[model samples]
Target: MNLLQKPILFPLNEKVRLIQYITGENSMLEHIELSIYDIEPGGKVSYHEENFESCVVVLSGKVTVDVLNGKIYSQLGTRTSVFDKVPTHSVYIGKNRFYTITAETKTRILIAASKTDQSLPDNLIKPEDVLIESRGSYHNKRYVQTILSDQDTISDKLLVVEVYTEGGNFSSYPPHKHDQNLLPKESILEETYYHEINPTQGFVFQRVYSDNRLLDQTMSCSNQDVVLVPKGYHPVGVPDGYTSYYLNIMAGPIKVWRFHDDPEHEWIKDRL
Candidate 1:
């Protein structure tokens, strides 16, 4: 299956230029929907979800989010590039809520959604509230920012995170899969990776494959490219001279994340 999706350019006059990375109508995903919106200043995008919850992540510039009931969140972002290596701000909107986002400046946002009936209050996630972790060691090292985790019952099935892999490094290393719903072992989850290259012109290599090679594809993904992982052990490798950044959105029947690493590559963990 061809899982790599590239964004089609839209004219600047279009107040809101949206690229639907993954949606129920377009993909094999069962629980997640991902989209990217590039809104010019003074532009607005509104949404009302009847049976799904969503989280809006600011990738660049600033914006204000108004959740219809006179609740307004203003100036919600900073940093002009994902390469800034800074934690971003995001807003979580529960099912049955109506929210509008107005760009205070030229802004880019990523929204991830999943089916849910959880009656959670809408909340804003600040940069300081994000947990930053450094995983792996040496060349396999990568920095991770956890946006939403299972510990936070505020969300139903969505798990969001941002990762930064330095030049000539590896991420999602030792190839792992979470496509089985066995508690304490692995949980079934479908995921989407939205990638951005530091130099913009550079690219990263991502591989999606099953043990029997039933599903295997290695792709050269550029900026604004999205990769879907329906069922497989997926991993990424970055070429030298350019850094790679990607926002990952995952959803499944279970909220927690547990994975099984490929036995062949499991030994790599010992060296780390």
Candidate 2:
């Protein structure tokens, strides 16, 4: 099957959307899952872990997360929006856990999950702890914030991060792929990009392809759209006047991020 077919993008609607839930059950993916929640003020949702570990990222607005029936509770501060250029907040809950989320205001949240057997305690990731770094150079430069990855916290099979590509800039550049488990070189991983374009009507372009060219696709993505990378060299570009924010969720046999740049475009690194 074509790898591009793995990516399922959904336009935002009045109800919550489960891109992963709709695509995962029938796709080749076995590790990662994702869902989006659009809640109004005073709205609440309850959850009980069912053999998977999950990380809830508040894309916008304030929220109170109650875990273990309130045994561990926290009221997370708010971000005006993902495009606000500020660090966001998140909470990670382990397998078989129970939790509830109540919104203090209109909000949007992304919940990414991966099956695991490890029993780790639930924890909150504060804005102060989010590591923000600038990568690439010139038009390729973009900001990356590590949310739940190996560098931030240990996880059994989940890696979460967010990236901001300035208008007209590029991200996940130099065209890289992590579809082969060649340790010390590249590790196989399945990834998903949940995008939110600033201005709501703006859009971005993402290309996913394989070395042999057997699977290739260039997608025009807009707000709340999702793109999945089962295996390929994926890169994204934002148009002028439209900043792009994408929450990346990934999983694989290994917990580390090891990728190989497309040799044809590796030369671009010298110019950066």
Candidate 3:
């Protein structure tokens, strides 16, 4: 129900923690953003989005979706994911109200006064299309996966990876960016860094711009923090003894895994 503007911080607690919508409207990617809902034991949110596609993942407790597939309410399993670009489905939490993330996949265009067509858009994914990767990508390479994302395999592919590192830095030593267009097999993808440093933890500075003299500026990011990267070259720096993680959501017009690092930091590539 809300779009993230500035990074909102959430403290770690013994009980369940809930961080609602990351953004309101424009804050979402392609009108899609992550929603974290906290539900109490036996709590439930009625399913019924006139025009919204929801995908649910259980980070903690188990949840069952008394879903309405065609006619009857088909009960889904724990950690059940649904690309509900079809109809409005309600959510009912189990023992403890669990958190649910909802992203809009169905394309709904406006026409007249609040009234528009309800036909399923081309991007509207089927229930089966919500593919979940149990075992993530890149186990080593000094990387860790937090969130399980269903990588979009459409024409233009943007890979979203929630990565964490132990005393290890990501995108370290090298600053990179791709600001061009190429064949589907070799295209350029923009990079953005929204940092989240643990509390009682040190700070991390991110430098972004078009190389040197490209309007250089650094921002101090911490827990529940964020930084936007539309274009230009950028890199992240995490001091020692601190752990960190980030949600890198991507989308392009092609289905290829290609990237280009900044000229200065490209040297570290050979070591990897």
Candidate 4:
């Protein structure tokens, strides 16, 4: 059966230059820009504003991230990811100018910040604030480098965070929505879920609006299957058994999210 039948996804077959900005698809939450990114062993992504709340996840090597505010190389989460929401200029010093999976991507999602996204509060949590959360699965009770999570300290200009649930673990269980303005503390942030399931087997279910029929999408994603949730009340359903994970890149008008449940399954919330 076909698993990944969601939105549009563009793949890269080659490497990117040192300073290049490639546009990504226009998702509901924000406009995206993806690049392969090259650092000369001791180079940094443009010294631009933390504008756009960007994220850099190491796919295959090591990077020493440094902030200008006396915050030296804070964390070395090689084989993991790092996130920073505050406004600060960063410099990434790599081991060499060789080729490894390093990505520089920006998200347009914002909350309580100017559209230009050029504001900082002076002192943010130290580089130590940038912590790496593992996002992988366990095989035979042995850990495998599958999934990880690294969230920013500011909790403002959010970027992408990786989440890996057990192959059969149910995440985002009951269907829900983030469009309810009434529950600002609950349902307010737009989301974009990029999936990576194990063995590329099994399927994930996501449902949007429907005039008469449910605009549901069942994706059996492998390496690259992206689903952009702009403004629909959505929920994810992981089948009975399947190791699953996704890089959830989100941003919106509000800082936090409180999604509402579908009327039919609203009862599940009480028991859960």
Candidate 5:
């Protein structure tokens, strides 16, 4: 087995492959798993009992999600592309359930799964139900759409959110970390950022570091790339002229999200 580096980044080429499983034997991931699927019109993908909680987010085009052999099903999606910055659709399926996704058009979907035994319901999150909010001040401002979690829907261990940062803006600002299991202060969570740049050729920069700089690393990322955050304060910067979009998927021992910001930059929040 090959383990991935702390901040693993990889580009995705949709033209050569239909489905790319981002994390595998060569990755350091222990709980969270992710994959990107490029399905053609009328294409289908099936899954049996895998004993994992999963969320299928339609990045573009239309698709019908059939769970438990159509016992639970829904047609979701609308954004022509992720760069459109519009709210899209997603489906959450609980552990040990069979599911199938059928594309009605050329579609790109993100499948994020986490091993769990918690019993939750199979549900659909419509565009309207997605909580969209703008955070930060001036140049640091960015839009965030929460797809699943305690604040919106009920789930066992999966937490999903989509973030859109304008060109030259900062996201996950001030640097925050959820790497400790400190009850009310912070909770240990493993996260991944699936990125998509506006121009399809643009890029972004991300930093992951610990208190003592033991795991510090700054990485340049391009469209259809993924950044894995195992721990530490993570912050992102989008260069001028390119809007950045990333789908965040997180899961850990606790279902709640409690984080601690880098003390040095935490002051920035007071002025916001």
Candidate 6:
């Protein structure tokens, strides 16, 4: 199966351009749903999910979100690009709630959802609320921002994060897999990577492989492209002279994230 999904041009319409990547039938993912929205100024998109807890992440530009016709968050984002290295604004709406996003400017956003039985309060995660960290060392260096995690009680089966990698560097390195359900050793989780290149013309390579070689694929991903990791050790590498940014949405039977590195490559961590 081709894991890389390229963007398709949508018909010109007055409403926002919505690309549904993982809406049940179109994707191999069973526990996750992802969509991206491109909205012109004054355009709006409304949605209500009956069984999934959803998160709205403002990728760029500005917007206002209204939840359940009562609570409204105004002017939530201001980044010129996802590469701004600044934290983004995100909203979490629990199951069976209605929400509308109206674009105050030309905007792009991502929605990630997963099944949940819990109904929690809505939360507007401000830029300051996101935890940013510099991970790895030397060539493996990358920036990470946690948007939603198991630590946050708002969502039951969703985890979201944004990562930035410099040219000639690697992210999700040393090859790790979380396809097993072992508690402290590993947990089963399917992931989707929404990639954006700095120059918009550059590309990156991501490799997905398993230990027994049952699944192995290397995908060349461009801007606005998405790569799915159903079950494998997935890692990304950026070419020289271009930067890489990707928004990752993960979900599984269990909410916690535990990964085990490939045994052969596990020695690299000891040297680091």
lDDT of 4: 0.41
C-alpha RMSD values across all candidates: 1.3, 2.9, 10.2, 8.9, 3.3, 1.2
lDDT (0 to 1) per candidate: 0.90, 0.81, 0.39, 0.41, 0.82, 0.89
In model 1, the clashing pairs are: none
Q: Tens digits of per-residue lDDT for model 6 on 93-197?
A: 888998999989999989999988888788889999898899888778899999997787768898999999999999999889899999988999999999999
lDDT of 3 at 67: 38
TM-score of 4: 0.57
For candidate 3, write residues 1-272 as lDDT tens digits: 12113433342233323443432254423322344444444444333434333334332233344334322223322222211112222222211122322222211110000111222211222234433333212312335332213243221233444444434464433565554575542454433343445533556666666655555666665655555554555566666777655545433333244456676756665655
- Highest lDDT: which candidate? 1
Any runs in candidate 3 off by more than 4 Å, and if so which? 1-5, 9-32, 37-61, 65-67, 70-141, 146-158, 168-173, 184-202, 211-216
Q: Answer with 1 or 5, whichever has the higher lDDT.
A: 1
What's the lDDT of the predicted structure labeled candidate 6?
0.89
What would the per-residue lDDT of candidate 1 be over residues 214-259, giving only the tens digit for each residue?
A: 8999999999999999989989999999999999999998798999
Give the alpha carbon lDDT tens digit for every residue of 189-240 in model 2.
Answer: 8998888887889989999999999888998887877788989999999999
In terms of TM-score, how similar is model 2 to the real structure?
0.91
Error of 1 at 37 (Å): 1.0
Candidate 4 displacement at residue 263 in angstroms: 2.1
The 10-residue segment of model 1 with minimum total lDDT is: 8-17
CA-RMSD of model 6: 1.2
C-alpha TM-score for every candidate: 0.97, 0.91, 0.54, 0.57, 0.91, 0.97
- Cα error, residue 193 of model 1, in Å, equals 0.3
Clashes of 3: 20
The stretch of ten residues in a row with the least summed lDDT in candidate 4 is: 107-116
